[model samples]
Target: MRRAPTQKRSRDRVENILKAACELISASGSDTMKMGELAEKAGVSIGSLYQYFPDKASIIHALAERYNEESQHCLDEALADVTTQSGLIAAFDQLIDTYYDLFLAEPVICDIWTGTQADKTLRDMELEVSRANAQSLVRTILRLRDNDGDGATFAARCLLIMYTGEATMRLAISVPASEGREIISSYKRMMGRELSEMLQV
Candidate 1:
């Protein structure tokens, strides 16, 4: 945002703007979303909208941040009780289910996922979020298992899992619901096999 909304009313207006933008983008991809249209949908003046988000990219960035925050919360909750190999697999299952449901519920996620790949700023933000998640996974693994392996190496492996899972999720979300389920099921099976093998090593 160009300036953070300090007042309650200001914050509400910004929220409306973001909500309107997401609805618009969800209905008709981000490329067609204009600031004037967004302002009208948000029931705010164009100047008022500009006060919080200077441009389209800023609005998209804010939306991306929101998505990232929600995803982080889901991951944290899913990992909260993980302390064994089976628990880790179950945690991953919950995480994947949460993401799949989120994508279905929030159509804006499709745009955000694609946008991050093309925008450097968004991509960097994505990597930062991934690294944080990887660290969280690393800590969980160490707490559950006794290993003398390099911590950084384990973290890097966790990062790989996160990225691959995300990529598979993107693809899963892009297909029909039935096909998406099958895709996620296959993904979980593959991940379960890999993680089970890792536990043995």
Candidate 2:
């Protein structure tokens, strides 16, 4: 953004702009998104929109940041009560389901996934968010399994699971709902089995 919104009204305007942009990108592909249309949908002046975001990429980046924040909050909540092995499995299931639902509910997420890949800054931001989430998962795992060896190795494994889950989810999101559910279920089973074995080792 050119300047961060300081006042409440300015912040609200920025939020509206981002919301409108998300809706537009969800309905129509991001390649065709127009600043004028975004401003009109947001019920804000074009100048006001420009005052916050200079271009469409910036708007998408802000939306991506919003998604990351929401996802992190969901992860925290899902993992909060995890202690036993069963609890960990349940937490992982909940996390996967939550993300699947989120991806299906927000079409703009598809845009964020595909659109931000080429942008190094956006990709770095996403990676940082993912790493933070992985760190949280690592802490939970270490707390539950006090004897587990090498915290860094365990954390890397956790990161791998997250990356694989995201890849599966990306593919699942494009398929039919029934097929997607099956794909996710298969993933959960595989991940659960692997985790069970890992905990035993």
Highest TM-score model number: 1
Count of residue pairs whose backbone atoms collide, per candidate: 0, 0
Local accuracy of candidate 2 as per-residue lDDT tens digits, 1-201: 998988998888888888788788889878899999999999988898888889988888888888889888888888888878888888899889988988888788977776556889887887788788888878877777786667888778878777777678878887899999999999999989867765664
Cα RMSD of all models vs. native, in order, equals 1.8, 1.8
| Residue 194 accuracy (lDDT) in model 2 | 68
lDDT of 1 at 140: 75
Q: What is the C-alpha lDDT of each candidate?
A: 0.85, 0.83
TM-score of each: 0.91, 0.91
Task: Residues 1-201, candidate 1: write the lDDT tens digits.
Answer: 999999999999999999999899989999999999999999999999989999999999999998888888878777888778999998898788878887888879888886667899987888888888888787777766675446787788888888877788788887899999999999889878866766664
Q: What is the lDDT of residue 186 in candidate 1?
A: 92
Cα lDDT, model 2, residue 176: 98
Q: Top lDDT: which candidate number?
A: 1
